[model samples]
Target chain A: MTKRIQQFLNEQKPATPCVVIDLDVIKNNYGSMRTHLPLAQVFYAVKANPAPEVVNLLVNEGSSFDVASVPEVDLCLSQGANPDNISFGNTIKKEPHIAYAYSKGIRLFAFDSEEELLKISRAAPGSKVYCRILVENEGAQWPLSRKFGCEVEMAEDLLCQARELGLVPYGVSFHVGSQQTDLSQWDVAMTRVASLFMTLQERGIELTAINLGGGFPAHYIEHVEEMPAYADAVMRAIVGHFGNRLPKLMIEPGRSMVGDSGVLQAEVVLVSRKSNDDCKRWVYLDAGKFNGLAETLDEAITYRVTTSRDGEETEPVILAGPTCDSVDVIYEKKEYSLPLGLKAGDLVQFHSTGAYTTSYASVNFNGFEPIKAYCI
Target chain B: MTKRIQQFLNEQKPATPCVVIDLDVIKNNYGSMRTHLPLAQVFYAVKANPAPEVVNLLVNEGSSFDVASVPEVDLCLSQGANPDNISFGNTIKKEPHIAYAYSKGIRLFAFDSEEELLKISRAAPGSKVYCRILVENEGAQWPLSRKFGCEVEMAEDLLCQARELGLVPYGVSFHVGSQQTDLSQWDVAMTRVASLFMTLQERGIELTAINLGGGFPAHYIEHVEEMPAYADAVMRAIVGHFGNRLPKLMIEPGRSMVGDSGVLQAEVVLVSRKSNDDCKRWVYLDAGKFNGLAETLDEAITYRVTTSRDGEETEPVILAGPTCDSVDVIYEKKEYSLPLGLKAGDLVQFHSTGAYTTSYASVNFNGFEPIKAYCI
Candidate 1:
């Protein structure tokens, strides 16, 4: 074990499952992003892991917050974040929630439709709202283009509707996609967003913020390294297109900001060979895909299984959760191995699990807290 | 809405996001499974939806239960399932869980390793254990070959180990992957399982039960009609192999028995657009991926999205959850036209959600119950 990890394990209270967030790592991540884009207002997308400690750390690191729901807004408010510093960046739906968010004095909201603009106007009159454009991340498998955001043709109509509804149109927002590996895609998206800005200005609407929505990859995975290149390209495009005319440049980064800072530590509940198949042996842990990480099975992100004990090595094994369902698996590869022969009670830490690993995928299918998260 | 669905919805209090289980639908599903596999013991895998009401319904319908973890065992027991009937199918992990399970008199265990046999010997002593085999369904995209089950060679060793430990090695078990659409694949798996049963007999192990582990599909979408053919092929294969000597056949059917019984009814919270594009519109619901049928996002389980007001036409829309993360989407390309335009406060029902949708996915992502489940 690394001296630091050993100390961390010693400090823990033997919970079979829990999320440990290293505040030091978080601060370092914050500094890294800050160093790369000094001009962009960094808003930590709190939905990734909105634990109070994580939020507090991001706030302490001088980053604002981007919240999509009322509970998230409440979480930030409870943590003493000024409402002015928050952006309810999702398209507002519930008129009541819009009023509630506005009542809490939240100003920066993201809207994508004329209907949503009309509803928000009815709920929170004259609210400052950002128009989200649906930028196509061409070639991405799971693109958000089909679900949310305005296509280029409809973007002007929604912006005009917001203006008509007395919702002060701030700037524009666009998300390329989550875990975006292609850095140059942002350049194409930026050009589209810039054109929208020009078109909106021609329609007599002055914007205040241009939110490049969060999709920055930040994990120990191989793909996370591509984030620096993506971030650089995004920032350069923002500067190149908008330049002095840029609204308050906002970047809501969820995975990139905190995904690496959190480690999901679970105990190897049972390690048993199912058969003498040429495939990998099975190792069941206390955690599963229900914890919002089906990707372990989807093979989206790889998990590096490590033990807290020093001099341990990995052996190839398949990983499953304690759930009775056959689909309850975390890792599917048989060729992978851990250094330590992970037995039932040994702790296995999955690195770079800070983001959607817990908050987004938790289902108490087996009736257990997904994982109790603690910030270091 | 059907009369059954109307009654169920009428009983629910307006919670932001919750699961509603129609008791009538559950009974119907149970009956359907019973009618088809009249002789086979139906062990309702509690890992699907462990709600006591759901389990109780199965018990009343004359179905036994299968549990993996201790809590699941306790959940079934608390619901009045016979302790002897509840199979603790997962390999024992913690000594305490095993000890407790044995004290509760759980005899049917799925054993996969040498350590598990040793634990069972020390804990239950006289427990009847089933040797789990890793049957490969070559057609399954994410096969279980690497996760659980022993290889044929290891099974012989493990069964020998069980006999040495004085454990009652009763039978063998294998599961085709979940949401299995291909019925022909089960033929290959069963052939291998039947071969293993004979192989074990050759090694002087008299096997009793040959459990074809559950991967029964439930129609959440139009393609769900494929389930019946798959079931027929499997049952015919099982009967063909053993020919009335199929030693008390047991199938751990979780989703098929109750998947259509449960519905994820969520309130549409926000409807907005994707930024930097034109035509993309997002319908944000109060429920996020944390609970509102993440199987739709994770496994691409296509669910039928409809309104409580029956006969209403649907609209093409992107459904999102309330979680702040961009990845917290429910439907990506699932085109469904709603009866009316989805506003903030209307209820959206996801059909065929009785299985892995609710029980397995609820995490306290935002310190909220992803879904509140109630059986009608």
Candidate 2:
């Protein structure tokens, strides 16, 4: 925990199962991204953590936003973001919501399919639209299924058709995947995107932008390379593929912007063994998959844990949330060690959980209120 | 869809991505339980769907409650349920919450470990405590992990210790699993419980209640046995082992009590293929895994769907929820067919969603509101 978060926790002592976000950390992350990737314009992905405080801070930092819904557009604009700086980045949007966004003065949007493009044309006329082409999500810890993007050839046709539909075929976009580790995936993506640009140019549609959809990782159980390394690799990929004719670059950083900025403090609800001679321990926490840690569904995003009884003898334990549902078990197959002395009421801190945790909490599953987040 | 739900949808036209629950269906389901399992007292599990209307109706019907949290206890009480009819069924609970439940006049509790039992004794002294023994989850579609119940031998010792700790050694409970298809699993659980009862009787503690933890099936894609069939098997297992001296039987029904009562109405946001030549269509809906259809994770529960274009020629489609996250894909591996003419703005209804649908919705994962529930 940072001194700021530690001091806040000590002084306020908010109830267990709440997250404390350090604003200074988000500001610092923004600064690091800017310094490392100066060529790219930063579009903060609001779905990662749409806390007003985070948005306001990013707004002050002159950050553009990659919004997924109309509410996000309203949120960003309410916090003093220029509509020009907001991009409706979700490919799947309701036609009415697109109109609502357009009415609010948002001009940029993303679409993966021709049907969605038609909706955009009818709703947000002359809006700058980008086609998200499907790219390999190999080497990502949380690999994205082929849900968001489309084939490169189809994207080329979509852009050519965009002109006829009275929409600006701005550029192309692709996601390597969330928490992507291998830098070579970006190389492959950039190469494919460069070919698409060449193909589109031949079709008389000049694309001006390239949305490098969020694939940059946050600190997880695995050792993640810093922004500098990712920036270096991304810049190399762009420069190596595009040569002198560089397109306007946009990077939507969701997890990297705020993931490490918060710490989720949960209390141990129960600790037990199925049998007396059972070697493994079962540790149940107050917060669970429904409340916050939904990323732990497949044990995909393992948050580094620090307990109140740290430094005590540790042993592998199965972690679960305090719910009646059996699927609420956090980590059973993966080995996670906790202090042997850890018992009910012991505080457990999940680190680097600022991004996806709070936003994914259920309304009142099992009568537990959504996990609370306190931004400092 | 039921005529009531269909009529309510036509009249209300509330919005896309909402659950319309027919209270009469819940009443009928409750009535079915009473008709089939006349011997066992029904303890309606509130976590499945804690809609106040559902609770109030069950309360009026004299159904006892199985609450997992303090809020659930309060919800049941607020709905005119007697505290004596409520059971703190979750084995994993905080000590303070236990005290709160006790303060609110709750006495029954569930426990699997010594630590939890110790807490209950300190917090809610002299409570009617039951041991949850681990049982096979082999035949369950949604098999519960060992996060809940303990080893049968360990459960025996725990019940014996419950007496020593000043708490009433009430009974034993075991869950076959959620969405359980196999009836034989109940037989195995009962035989073990019968053996435990004999062991406890010899030890001079007279256990009364035998909690047949919920494993009842709700309507999904698979054919489910009628309530009478399940009730008969369960009663036979109890009578076959205990002979003339049947223990006080308690059945906790969550899913079966409420599952078939709801119809989730969602609009198709977009319909597209990855490529023009792609074999399957990708259909996006306003509701998804984070919203009403959480059981669709791993395609565990395949809901029967009715589209506005239902009569049109159908084709196998990849179904996904409307979210930026790739993990939001609802059913990819499972062969879910949709109307060939299905397009944006088409209404699709997912049936048998009254239980876990609205309860598991994320608060604001992608700036989209939680799936709304309206009980009529």
* Tens digit of per-residue lDDT, candidate 1, span B1-376: 3567667577645464667777777787777767776667888888778888888877777788888677788788887888878888776456778789889888777777877777778878888888777766654433454556667777777777788888887888888777676677778877777887788788898878778778777775656444456668877888788787767678888777777777677887766554434244567777766665666655357777777554865546667776544567777666756654556677787777777666655556644555777777
> Whose lDDT is greatest here?
2
Model 2 residue A27 CA deviation (Å) reads 0.6
Top candidate by TM-score: 2
lDDT of candidate 2 over A289-359, digit per residue (tens): 99989999899999999999999999999999998988898888888888999988899999999999999
Give the root-mean-square deviation of each candidate in angstroms: 3.8, 0.9
Q: Single out the weakest 10-residue window by summed lDDT for candidate 2 chain A.
A: A213-222
Given candidate 1, what's the lDDT at residue B331?
A: 70
What is the TM-score of chain A, computed separately for every candidate?
A: 0.90, 0.99
Report the backbone clash tally of model 1.
Answer: 63
Once model 1 is optimally superposed onto the true structure by TM-score, how far is the C-alpha of residue A251 displaced, in angstroms? Answer: 2.3
Model-by-model DockQ, in order: 0.45, 0.93
iRMSD (1 decimal) for each model = 3.6, 0.7
TM-score of each: 0.88, 0.99
* Candidate 1 local lDDT, A1-376, one digit each (tens): 2345446768755576776777777787788777877768888888777888888777667778888668888888888788888887767456777789899998777777777787788877887887777677753323454455667667777777888877787778888877776677788898988888888789887777778887677554454445567667877888889786667778888777777777777887777655444444567778777654554655656756577553776657777777655566766643457644667677778877777676645556665556666677
Considering only chain B, what TM-score does candidate 2 achieve?
A: 0.99
